[model samples]
Target: MASRVTMIAHLFGAMATILMLVWLLHYRGGIDLDSDSNSDRIFNVHPFLMFFGFIFIAGEAIMGYRTVAAERKVQKLFHMVMHLIAITLGIIGIYAVFKYHDEIGLSDMYSLHSWIGLGTFCLFGLQWLFGFFSFWLPKSSLATRETMKPWHIFGGRALLYMAICSALTGLMEKATIMGLKRGNESRLINFTGLFILLFGLAVDLSLSLAY
Candidate 1:
């Protein structure tokens, strides 16, 4: 059952990523580190990275234990590694948006979406640090590990949910700012959002059912 749900989550995640790429490359212009000529191109990286890089990676990290047949230590290592990758990609995504805002002369971190997104990212980093110290190198004592286990799991789940919330809000904000009312672009945006939501839900359900 968990495997089936994980497959579905993978399918949805793939669809969301494809739709996102099509929207950015075909409509919004391809992503770049810093497209001075077109800041919109720079902005495209924000959503793609946040959805695929951060949220999707974190989702896989959350579900990997249920799906992989690895030893306990291996699974734990993989989980931590995935989260690290997610953080790297997440920070890059955040940077893209901040750079975009600067290029356009817009004030940074003003909107509700930015507030939630930045807050989530910061908390995510802190969570990773806590996890690393508690479970990874210079590990805590066995009793301490057992004591912190539940809180660790809860924090991981909570941060993933917050990331999803940020992604949804960011998507809507971009859609509204672009005034994509009734066009292929608008439809694509809506569909991407739908798949993203479905992917997150599937990930959450798969995790719950796994245990």
Candidate 2:
């Protein structure tokens, strides 16, 4: 059951990435880091990285234990590495948005989307640190790891939902700003949001079934 759900999650992840690319390349202009329209291009990086690099990779990390038939240590190492990569990309994604705002001379973190997105990113960082110290390192006792396990899992699940909320809100905010109203772009945005939501759902379901 868990394996099946994990596969579904992976499918959703791929769908989300394709939709995001379509939205950015077809709807918005193609990405350009050094062009005169760098602001818009840089802003495009935020959604791409956040969705594919951060959320999708993080989901895969969560499903690693259930999906991969590897040794415990191997699974743990892969999970941690995936999360670390996700965090690194998440940082770049956040920076991209901030750089876009700076280029446009707009204030940052003024919208609810930014507020939730930034807050979730901070919490994710803290969660990663706690997991690293509590489980990955041998400095902590087995009892300590057992005590922290539930909290870690719960926090991760909560953070995943928070990320999904951030993504959905960000998409809506962008659509409104771009004046998308009943068009192909708007439909693509809606489908992208649905895939994201489905990905989160599949991850959560897989985790629940695994345990």
Scored by lDDT, model 1 comes in at 0.89
Residue by residue across 1-211, what tens digits does model 2's lDDT show? Answer: 7778888999998999999999999877876655474478878989999999899999999999557788899999989999999999999888888888888999998899999999999999999999998898899888888888999999999999999999999999999998889978899999999999999999999989977
TM per candidate: 0.95, 0.97
Looking at candidate 1, the ten consecutive residues that score lowest on lDDT are: 65-74
Off by over 4 Å in 2: none
Per candidate, the number of residue pairs that clash is: 0, 0
Question: Runs in model 1 with CA error above 4 Å?
Answer: none
Q: For each candidate, what is the lDDT?
A: 0.89, 0.91
TM-score of 1: 0.95
Q: Per-residue error at 197 for model 1, in Å?
A: 0.8
Q: Candidate 1 residues 133-188, lDDT tens each? A: 99897657999999998898888778878888898898899899887789889999
**Candidate no. 2 TM-score:** 0.97
For model 2, which pairs clash?
none
